[model samples]
Target: MTFVVPVHQQGQQQTTSEVGILNNDLSLEREGALGLLERRRNEVVNRDLNTSTTAVQRNQEENGDDENAKKKQQRSQCSRGCKKDWLGDGWCDSACNTEACGFDEGDCLGWCSGDCKPSWEGDGYCDAACYVAACNWDRGDCSRWREQGVDAVERRALQQKLRQFQQHRLQLPECKCERRLLVNGSCTPECNVPECLFDGGECLDMCNAKCSKSWLGDGDCDRECDTPECAYDKGDCASTTNATLQAMRKENGTLEVCDSTCRLWMIGNGVCDKQCNNAACGYDNGDCDNITAVVEIDYSVEPEAVYQFCAKEWIGDGHCDANCYNKPSRWDGGDCEGTEFEVEQAAKGIGPQYDQ
Candidate 1:
């Protein structure tokens, strides 16, 4: 018996197997087709793995380049003395030294010299030497030493000796003079001198006087007034003279003995009469009666004729009035009370002048 078979093409065709399926039995054809499908699937999986590996390697290379660039930037910043944390990891301590730190040289030197502490040792004693040198330089005539015009080598040697002396002085327990005290490794001038002097004299005694009448007699003596009169006059002579005059006047006019006789009829003795009513004298022999007199006043309003005399020598009279407009009917008397529209119309001489 002869059999006819149909072939179906679905996708791209694969290479033909050495063992052909054309003349093969039904089971052999099925096995060949299965093997070809498995081989295509394996090729696809291997290609994907290779592509993924290449991508991972590229990413790693890029990451390494970024890290190297960051390190270079950090080094550049460190060179500029702008490192955020000088003591942190990867930071160079040499970049933050006295000369390279970009801070105040004196302050940085002092810090590096360990002058910030109460006591120092070895190289730390440099600040103390600087401090003593500064004190002696301030107090002594350093200009004299410069005037010698020593050579550069000798000058440098002398400077080194002075520095050494300063350091040695700093190592001492205490400064001999208060002015020698070092502030930031420099001496401060003494400032305890008195500004003014107090001399023991009469003026000083008068200045301390506590008498109440001193203000009226003589004022307190001071540097401005070093005399006795300044304290004795309590400063006011006019008021004291006026008070003395007033006392004399009161005694002579009001407190005098009355030698006049009383005119009262009911009095037993006209000598000691206490009911005297005379205007010239209110007392009889010595005692005076305390009687007060009342005076009456009238407060009535009366009309009086007021005569206004106008000068007949009129010079500029009626001159201003003739030119001035006193009545509203006059043209120059300003616009009469009217609405804004009417005023505007009158200003332009429209609509009957609006009564103004």
Candidate 2:
């Protein structure tokens, strides 16, 4: 039988055990190759990380050095400031280091003999030798000395002329409305306003008389203020002189008259019902008290308003029972009416509340 099998045929007829052994060898080789590739990748990644970290650290160190250098330069500059100033003791640094609120060049020039003035570059009064541009030079005291030193009489004349010129130039709008300004937690104006029938401020127009300003502060004004509510007056308003509001029904009709002292109600009426329960009434207000609001009047008539009762049925507003009051009011005597009541009665009982 002595038969020798061909190599190709032997390979084709390989047993299961042989096939398993070859597969194991191939897997081992594959694993070894993969391990080598992973090792190379890890080395490259580590090298990149080290390079990046070194670059970052170097940049941070350089930034720190630059910051230090800048601070050193600033210090040197400040040292020179001490010699530059008149006192020769101050650093170049201004009062406000933060340029946002920095001072002007002549801010700390010398000791201010009078009121400390703002820098020469600001808009304020120059109480010191150096100060900012004085914006108020358009008129007033500065106007007289606009060019040079002048005598008092000449200066006064120049100031008056300048003021007149400015007034002529600045005219009020046709719409007569009051304007307001802010100052010292209060809305005060720039000029002195006298008291008349208006507040102590400059009148916008010639519609009202100029008030005599005795007080410097601001107050309400109404040129035609016939009653308590002070209407807005374009002109300067004046404070009340006597601290008493005089109201009267007119001479012919029952309309309130001005000749008599301020009265509350007409006597000849039905169901007189008057009450005092408001803040101004001095009746029951928690905070307001019954202080004697005395008023000086010229009329020789015996005061009757201080002791009269309210005519309930004759009250201007039908709701007078709830609001109309009569207390011992010095101004109106006894029959003092509230603002609402006054307006209603003045309009002959025609008002919002009465209509409603």
Candidate 3:
């Protein structure tokens, strides 16, 4: 009797197996054929692996030999599904510290030593540390000056304008809220904010001001607590010059009537007003602490016209935001590179032209 058998190789190109005809008595011939086919399969696998390795080498050469690049390569080695849950779970898996991941949800923050938050990619401030391919050329912040086609003259003028704007902004009125207090006499807030220190003990009610210790020395002069029995609001209102309104004392020793605005109109109004970024108004009822960015503001116009620049939705939607521009470590995800206007400039030879 005679038999014919087929041998399959585990390779994509070798889907069809080799066939060998054998005589029942000729076992030696069948063994030789099987061995030959096995060797052929091995060769195909080795070739495929070598080809993949060469492609990787070429990519590395183009990207340069940076630590981030190496980490990016490691991230590529693993599929997203493999590291899905662990990507941003507060544990910097060290293995998943690539930009493709969320920098381990900022858990690996100290590793870079410089600002490399994924959100800080294009926030206008050029981060020297993020000037690499892995970080998308710092999300285009470093090269945006040239890419936007600005000539030396324009660059100088724009820089001057920026400086002036910054100085002017500094002159703007800054409002502060009074710090909350606890039983420990420590200056802190009643909330769970670690940056401000949280008070665990029960609030102490004192001074016959119908208020707790947290409200006695609070910056805002509480009407009920302004009596001398309350030590004139624990001296929080000593400099309040407004005799009639008894308004809150501003940091500059002026009086700011915050009666209606701070309590009703501004707090919980869904706007993170700079004046409300303090304990007096519950930190704008938690709005000021949300993930927000100032994408655009025309300081050339009146400050009132552009006061509400920060918006929570602009941080991660993959668009280069104006507020995030030039701000180191305050990126707009990975969206910004150069401006469309700059691209136009490049065409006119007034600025650097990058290949699209």
Candidate 4:
């Protein structure tokens, strides 16, 4: 029993066979095109390799040729006129003296046995003509006053070395000397010669001539000496009653003065004396709590009496009176017992029994 296909089914089967044949043809064509491309790539690679090898070989051959040519040139030059053996034979022969002979291959670096010419003796040129003894050593020109070496060139070099050595051997004046130590940027007592400017100006003023150690503590205050170099002339300028501060206040026309008292009695009084509130007075012996106001002093009363009066008035006022500082009474009604000033005084081993 054979099964027969319908007419429509038969046409579809025929169309499918044709399509399969066309696909096989396309696959074969694609493979052939790929093979051709691969062959072309291999050809290009092989050709490039060969070309690079050839260029490298050609460059090497060219370099070798150049070297051979240079060698031939040198050989020709060495063989002409002066043989290679005669070039450095220690004799400065006229035949081998040309530049082509390498200047006799440096064989003529020293004195030679050539005839001396009087005209060329002192011409300042170091040649065979002036190298002989009979030329009076080139009339003192070839060696330029340095004639002990093998040649003029070597002598000149030796002269330069001598100059450098002399320069290196030179020494500056020692600062240890009195003359140099005075200006040596440091203060020293040994150099304090008053005749020397300001005793070298270190122990005194560096610029002002008048500010010297000679006038530092002298009874009279030199206005120019009123500087740190002279310790502000403490002998005269320290007290407010001194002439310096008084004159300064008078110049300013202000009777009020900042009391920079150093005396223990003037510090820490109940009154905030203007001059007493400074470090020289132990910060007014710690009495300057309120700097906005300052109590006036009655000039008619004795200073000690005034202090006693002020101490009594400010007692037990929540502050210690400076005048009562470390006093036998430990004044101020014990207000200073726990204060910072009291602690500081205690640290300093100060007490009512100890005198300042």
| lDDT winner | 4
lDDT of 4 by residue, 127-202 (tens): 3235446556666654522433444222234335434534696322322223334444564433332223223334
**TM-score, prediction 4:** 0.23
lDDT of 1 by residue, 131-185 (tens): 2232332222223333443221122343354456467774323222222232213
lDDT of 2: 0.32
List, in order, the clash count of every candidate structure.
Answer: 13, 32, 14, 8
RMSD of model 3 against the true structure:
28.5
Better of 2 and 4 by TM-score: 2
Worst 10 residues of 2 by lDDT: 190-199
On TM-score, the candidate that comes out on top is 2
TM-score-better candidate, 1 vs 2: 2
What is the C-alpha local distance difference test score of each model? 0.32, 0.32, 0.44, 0.49
Model 4, position 262, has a per-residue lDDT of 34
TM-score, structure 3 vs. true: 0.21
In candidate 2, stretches whose alpha carbon ends up further than 4 angstroms from where it belongs are 1-17, 80-92, 95-356
**Which sections of candidate 3 miss by over 4 Å?**
1-264, 294-306, 310-313, 326-329, 341-356
